[model samples]
Target: MANNRNTSFLSDPALLEKVDKLRDLNIGQHVPLPQLVVVGDQSSGKSSLLESLTGIPFPKDQSLCTRYATQITSRRGDVDRVDIRIIAGPHASEEHRQHVEAFRMPTPSGLKFRQDFANILQKANEKMGLRADVSMANGTVFSEDVLKIEVQGPDEDYLTIIDVPGIFRTTTEGTTKDDMVMVRDLVTGYIKDERTIILAVLPSNVDVATQEILELAEDYDKDGRRTLGILTKPDLVLEHGAQAAVCDLIQGKKRPLTLGYFLVRNRGPNLESEDQSELDQIFRTQPWISLPQDRMGIPALKEQLGSLLFEITQREYPKLLQDVSSQISKCRRDLDSLGPSRQDEREQRSFLTHIAGVFQDRARAALMADYNSDSVFDQVQLRLITHVVNITDLFSAEFQQSAHLRHFQNPELHEPAEETVSSGEDFQGSNSLGLTISNLQDLLQATGVNDITQEELAELGEIIDLSHETTLPSDDVTSWIRDTYLNTRGMDLGTFNANVIATTFSEQSRKWGDMTKVYMSRVIVTIHRFIATTLRSVFPEEQSRRHLWSSILDGLLQRYKMAMDQASLLIEVERHKNPYTLNRQFADALSKARGHRITELLRPKARKDTRQYGELQNMVNLDDIAKAAEGKSNMEQQQEEIHDIVRAYYQLALDRFIDNIFQLAVDYSLLHGPDSPLKVFTQEWVINLEPEQLERIVGESKVAKKRRLKLAKKIQDLSSALKILKI
Candidate 1:
């Protein structure tokens, strides 16, 4: 009854053939295929079991043990046919693939097919360059490549099993410790795949704990959900009085598995018959018969494996289709990024021309401030015009804050104050100097200068902030200016020498050149970033992009240096050239400055007490005003006038300097001119390149070629798989 039940669902041709077609397409190499993989230690009857399942002869001797993974597939067909081939390993070079592909054997039929199987394997071994003896040390002892065999006959069952090299403990002749590790890694590689159902074959005569395959299965499938334990050679265990232990394992009393265990008796050296009756007869005789009847024969093992494979194939088919589709999309996308191949000079030039055209358009857009065109422009740093304007504004504001050598403060005032006179203010009369001073009407009225207006004081404060202003304090600046005025007093009396003021102005503006260089560097960096981003988008391949950069960057940098030199020369001329301005605003600025300073000096003489004057108006002291100017000489007043002239000229120069740095240096050298950096990689430049230069810049790399071929093959195989799956 048990035998009849086991043979009923042993083969399902329709479903199994679909999977066979997928495997034949080599889909398993890229993605895991639903199948059973047989694993065991050496001398564990693993080969005999495969022979029982496939009816093809496997080498039974220890010397001819499997040196690589063998994929044996048997299914029903009208005529008997046997085909063999090698699937190259991942690391196999092109030369090795050719050798593997060249291995062939003559077609044989009937009894002759079985007879030629061993010769076919021997030829395959030689083709793989495996050594014959452990001590030879000439050829590799193991390979990662796989040997695939397909057998078709009317009587065959629909089954596929991958048999890996049996695990071995110690090294033998011609084999070293490396071979052991290689074999272990090779076996574990197949068993660890989640899609494969592991078939662990163990010899019942040996202790089950000693079997390496079982340990590996436990490591990979700890819950034993997809692992099946097969105990072979129950007859040998009977002689050792270990039948009870084997029975315990079969009955789930020890080392139990979710899929349970099965006991099978295989053919001995003297017994060459392959039959389930022989196995049944031996189990019926004694203690073996006391084990579970349903789990004791080869037929039950085959039945269980068939059901498991069918179930897994059905469950994993949808996911397998999705995986194949995903791989196809990824491969095609990678190929697209590589662009079309260019083997010759004309093709290389054409490809480079296309890239250069794209670069030109992007750079033009950036220069024009049209940032809506490309996605790369989404980064704020890459927006050329906006960033340049922002940094330039910051440069101008910083110069306004720190350009002065010293900040002047009136010593008589309660708080430190800056002159707040506006250029629009009107002055009526002239003082002792040649400057027109405001508030002469009040001086003539003998009330000194009237109270300073809020509107007048707010004008200079609007242009520059006073709270965070940076410079030397009043005491240091006054002493320095006074000492210089006395030392340079040549042919002048009651006034400061003009050279002292000129020399002071030159020293105060020394920081402009260094600041301009830093500004230019920032602009260069921005241009380079935009160029690099354009290159990445145009040439997705790294090697080609690097070559093109080398070809064009020298010209761009030379232009930058030329412009930089011109800019530095402009600074040199400005520093050494006489301080002169043709603009008429300088006089108005100086007059307002004098009015503010004289008002501050006169305010100390006004009486703030309401008893002396009214609440809004202040009474002036003529004696206090004389003490404010001088008792014997007018040198302090001369120093005050000199300080006012320098302040007015510095403001005029700062405005002109900022404009020159942006327009003359950055715009002309890097962005706008015919030979500017933006014009370095135009289509005309590509056409002008010498043939050798074109090849040097655009030649395809070996790694890129290999990658293109790999992706192309992967896309082809996956497309075929999709068709086979009927998706």
Candidate 2:
């Protein structure tokens, strides 16, 4: 075996200088580039093969000579020879420089272009040899240097040949294994581009068609063409009489192999003439191998590589086009099968109305049951009466001690004017009405009751008696409480009953309202998100879901918060407690249950009374509502008015649960993009399901085989629909 300590192209100073120039030039930008990766078992002639191919013998010391990845390129004008450059990890940089410098000293012949490289390395080595032992922060010791060669052929096609450390030796050390994995990934990444080809070199004694090699060959063959394999030390095979057997193995078992193997003898002047003739015959049989006896093996291999490279380049063009076309076709298909159109929206509204009616019927039945069992309203009245009596008892002493109440007992109360304001100014309103009532109560307290006349006292007594007579008994507080809180709450909860009925009713009502709004908004937003973001991610489009979602969420939240705040302030002024504030707090709690935003709570409700009007408007096929108002068209005006009313109703509903609706929109977008194949399939299934089956699936019930069968039928229907749409 060769001493394995031999250093060749890596030591060439001229090549090193050329590598620097290539790096500075940035040749990676050029088109039709080739990445040539060299892979083999340790001491299996990987570097030797690269040296032979690139006309630059790489160092082959038993100690790892190549560590990390490296790149070598020729100077732009120089096509005949290459420049060597090293690519090392951050930790290996200093050590690699030293090795590169040491190799450059006493550069070999025919490396005239790398004269500057030789001087630079010599100078660097002499100055920094001591610092080479200085380790990087990472634990990895810089020991090996990978040699990269960039060859520019006469055709101006650039080929990058990477000479990696052998894989087998890497397993011996944990660190080495890590390095090997990284190197493998790097090599794989380069080769996966489809423009690159891997050249695997095997020793003559080793089997040419080992299972491992076959697997490697298959992986390397992106275009289904076996990588070129070289059988080095052909003379050894000739002496062992294994040449015919090797040939049989390669030709018969590895029948699909792209390039045939060649027998190469590395021995220089000592090789015999008879041996040379035998080598020539072997070369003749494997015309793919370029091995010249007169010249160094480097030139011959380079020539052969150039031809092989040209063939690979020709194949890549068509393949790239095919990949692009396939992607475009997929994008077109996705665009055709997206969510609800105008017709779909109308149908969905109708469906919602039907569902609402069902829920209302259930709610009325539950209410009747409560009514039959001492009625919620009656209980509420009794409770209010008891509360009034309790309040009177609590403040009875204060009422009796007030002399101002006695004097003001018969005082006339003035009402506000009934005439409408006809001023040009807009209506200005305040909470003064409540303040005025409070002031009147305060006046009665300040005055002494002894100042009042007997007639006035009799009138006050009669008023008090009337109030007490109108109030219900304390025993009926339950019915009154039910009327005030539970009935209002039960409007949405349907037949559900529990203790703390009012609180439960309120909570359920708020939850359902938010959920419904969120779901509806989510469906719409999901479609938008798919169109705006998801499709772009999958189809190489401009916009992304992340960007779209971020923008939409930011904008929607800002607007919704502002609107809610204003609405809350108005409600607080009118009702003495901020409704919007309470709604927001409720929404926050509801979101915890749903684990999502509740933006859908803001969607406007369609008017039930305007169903006929909506149907008539739909028949008119108005493209734009604004256009309908032009030319004094009464029907168009009426249609516009109806639309405005619908919009107002929608706005009111949305105002009640904006957070939920917005959240739903975001969720919908995330779930229905082009990249969301699962979501798309799910949506398709939902759209195709029978009405009853869909209801069951969406409802709380869990039916197994029936559900599965229904789901399967839905999928089938969706598939048929998609087929019709050519999606």
Candidate 3:
């Protein structure tokens, strides 16, 4: 019971202020406010029930029916009068503001009610600009505008309800079929709000299953989650001998909803002549009413509704925090987009600085690999220092260890200054001897010498080449014979293979260049979007912001191209020629690898080579030596040499390439290439502006201004609501 006492806290006047103010701010739009939505067929005692609840003297003229939704929101106040305040639809441009002010209905201090409800309705219709316009057949026949009736008194319950205009089955004289659709649509709109508790008022004279509103309610709330049934004409049920079924409905039987039905014999046409006390007495003691005191009459009805509202409020108050928070966040973004509303140039300059500093902070965070931010929109696909650096490291490791790199031309080895010419054409441990043999062959081919007779001519030619070579030792003679034998057979063996390795390596490494371009594009786009979004926010005026954006966008693009070209200029030097790289470690690694492969290939023929070569003197043909060569073309040996040379330098060039790529990406696309977003928004003279101009010249249009005010006010109202609902 003590825990149940918390319900009284919801009825606090502070909560009422929050609800009332929020209602006025959104004007029944945007955020869905919690309330009861009363639905019934036309003249089904909907108005009579509202009049009974409020104890207000509503007009008896049934002709002046409710044309729009009448939202009844009341709290316990000292005043005995009803405040009739009209909240026009958003589309009712002319009357929205004027009608929002409360029209107080004063009554003398007595049980006698004021008979001026008709005049008030007439005034409401006139204010809505709907005088006699119901008959006009222009298809847009109705409005979502609501007339709010606020009754404040110590005796009255603190409750909120929306009594929508009755559903119509047939077209009236002045109205077409559209009016029937209009009223239903209007009713459905209020009932559809999940925050609303549906009070479906079905007359007892009609079958509940046949009502279209009942079907609609069932569809919205399957198994009756938030719907409460109200049997308005209980007398008709008793007189017609259907009290047992009606009582079953009231006692939670047929069409059972989560909240069971309540029965009430409405004070119908004579509602204004009676007070709430008389109606209460009739409901408790009158046999004609024929309902239990707990489930019937205005008093029980008030208690049930109040308890239901408290239940709804308690269930949904936590969501109020979320709703208000979301609304505040959304409005803040919109308002930020509209930029700081500067009173003059000084504030405008300050605003520009603030936005610039904010962007700078975000960019620095991105550079430093901090991606977290308050704004949901503030995000990057990859941090410059995180993913890019990781990718760079990956590239370097893979490239350095690539199989394509066999070796490189060693700087440690050099060509001799002179060549030795002799019969002993020694090439053992000598880099220069190969050239001496080359000259001998050149002479033989050039002089047209051939056969045994030309063998002397070859000697003569070779001796002539002797002057070009230095002397050699007798021990080297054997080595020279083997060298001459090997050289005469083939020359320039591996030249083509080495050229191919260089070309392939050149081609493969260039792919990273294209990837660098793609990475740069992402960075540029991230910064570009950030600039446009943030700068547009500061300018506030759409037209001028767009114009400024377009102007600066062109300049930034041009600068981007220039920045890319500048970065490429540095990379272009490396692209044109391979670096003169000297990697000593790669030389040792390549030699060992090539030797291992050769040992594997030649191991099978080692025994045969030793036997055949040992018996070389008795050999009948050159086939033994030829076979001993074992496919070792001068071209292949040269190819192996070139492969080793290329392999050694591969790592050095790759490391340099990767480093250059990172530097280029950071410098050209991220830092000061096209002037960072932050710098672009806050710079000397601030681009496209004169010296005296403090900010971008822009205009705040009428519509933009209105939207700004509405959002701000709505935010204010929600802020209050959230504060009150915090408990």
Candidate 4:
């Protein structure tokens, strides 16, 4: 039946591709026979079963027998013939090969070739009664070297047997560092293959050791396929009624038992003979399997195993095939998308332009809301100076009252005036000195200073003296005063104020202005720095956002690739000479062809020359507006350019956002087989822009006409991009 199916399937190219996909996904492998892994307690008749099945004696003793995992394989032509090989380890190297020779005694020494050398070491450890710790440290543990052996039966069927360590017995010594390392490596290595089935052997009688083995197995079996329980030492249970009671207890407790118990005697020569009557009588006349005597039972067990193997193969293959095909298809799609096609370039440009516009719009709104007022530039400067003077006065007064400065007098308030007795050079310098004093007074008044009365000035002098006279340090007072002043007044300052002031005036001509600019700059810069630095420190949200976006993009891309690949494969398969190989080839072909046509239609196209020329003309008109705005006063130019940049960015970003929304809506419709919430939203969407808002953004305040024109051109370009993207 399998041969007929293969012949038919392979004849069709499309069917062949599907089969290839399955193969790539490791899904469809022709497994004719099932492999059995036998594991148990050290003296639980495990070796006896191995001997019974393979007709080969396995060494049995109490001192840690089966030190290494053994594999038994049947000879290719002879179903009844078997071969054994040991998995190699670090110590199985040539240098240590001789040390293992003693264990393979009685077996042919010719088998001690390089290929068999590792097995010799394992066998030696088993026979020599090496402690698990020593063997493990020396790296001679059997679990570390899982064995594989194939057994060919007379019926042309083969059984591959894996003999692993009786974990129940091995772990009895208590977990050591070496044991843990070895166990970890063993479990990892054993379970690495999803197809590998685990068979756990347990005594028929219930015990704490058996429970522990089951628990350990459960912990390590990720797919839950490999761990199976095999009840051994059934003969012991038959001989003693207590054993039957133990089995009853275990069964009552609901212990997981996959395979039924095998009744076998390990210590006697009549092991091959069936004693069914005696075994039945011992177990109160219940049906039970008697090993060696129950030869017919072995074939039954093999048949059961064959069924399981077939089921697993069928379950895993198709899925694997589907996954591999999907991955390949996705890669092809991505390559196509990334190519320098005019459509792709147009799409990318459109997307970028949309994004830029959205940013510009948001920035424009923020700036307008923050900076829109009548004569705001001049008002901001005047307000800043007034705030600084008030803060300084308050701080000075606080410092004078502070305990640390109690001993010092204020020089400005207490110093005696110099007598004006002019010498020949002094007479000429008086005019310049008088002018300087008058100018300083005018500047102080402009900063909102009121005339200080002589009596109030004397009171201020007394307070300063009191502050200096105190025992506390002056540094504390200075710090406190500075903090109080900055905190109360500097908190309201904007980041651009100082830069604006500096740009407005020269350093030499306006000493007070420069001082004000420097101080305000420090304040604004410090506040902005604090906000930025604190956000980064407190919330790694930016990094998290990036990671989230990347993951989302990856998942979306993967799904897209899969769909494309499946579509492509579907198309390829329909073109086959023998379409009937797959039952649904015609339907798949039509669906895929329709999808491809739609995708082609959706592909973007670059703008035409006429459209480009129209956009350029719009841009030129906007540029003229900007140039006219730019020739105005410095303050006007700044405002106009700032407004233009902000608006342009906002428009660009908005366009991109709209485009994305539309794309998402389309994808949603495809996924759900109809329009979804996203589709509905896209359909109802409108880009709302208020004229009032735009006017607020480009304030009515006077700005250079040239700057306005420049800004207008940028806005036009941004709008053109948005139109192109249809956002």
User: So what's the TM-score on candidate 4?
Assistant: 0.34
Clashes of each: 5, 60, 20, 68
Q: Worst ten-residue run, lDDT, model 1?
A: 420-429
Q: Best by TM-score, which number?
A: 1
Per-residue CA lDDT of candidate 2, range 176-267, in tens?
55666665564454445556556666787766555244355567574445366656765456433466565553453444455554445443
lDDT of 4 by residue, 617-680 (tens): 2222333433443335544333322222222222232233223322332222213223321111
TM-score for each model: 0.77, 0.36, 0.55, 0.34
Which runs of model 1 end up more than 4 angstroms from their true locations?
1-14, 132-138, 273-280, 290-293, 333-375, 404-508, 521-556, 579-652, 678-701
Off by over 4 Å in 3: 1-34, 59-63, 73-79, 88-95, 98-113, 136-141, 152-160, 176-182, 193-195, 234-244, 268-293, 297-299, 310-549, 553-682, 685-708, 722-727
Measured over all alpha carbons after superposition, the RMSD of each candidate to the real structure, in angstroms, is 11.2, 28.8, 17.5, 32.6
Model 1: lDDT of residue 352: 92
Q: Model 3, range 231-347, lDDT digits (tens) per residue? A: 887656555446666767876767788888887766766354666567556455444356555777666777788777766766665676677788888988988777766545665
Shift in Å, residue 416, candidate 2: 32
TM for candidate 3 is 0.55
For lDDT, the strongest prediction is: 1
lDDT (0-100) at residue 97 of candidate 3?
60
- Model 3 residue 697 distance off true place after TM-score fit, in angstroms: 9.3
Which candidate model has the greater lDDT, 1 or 4? Answer: 1
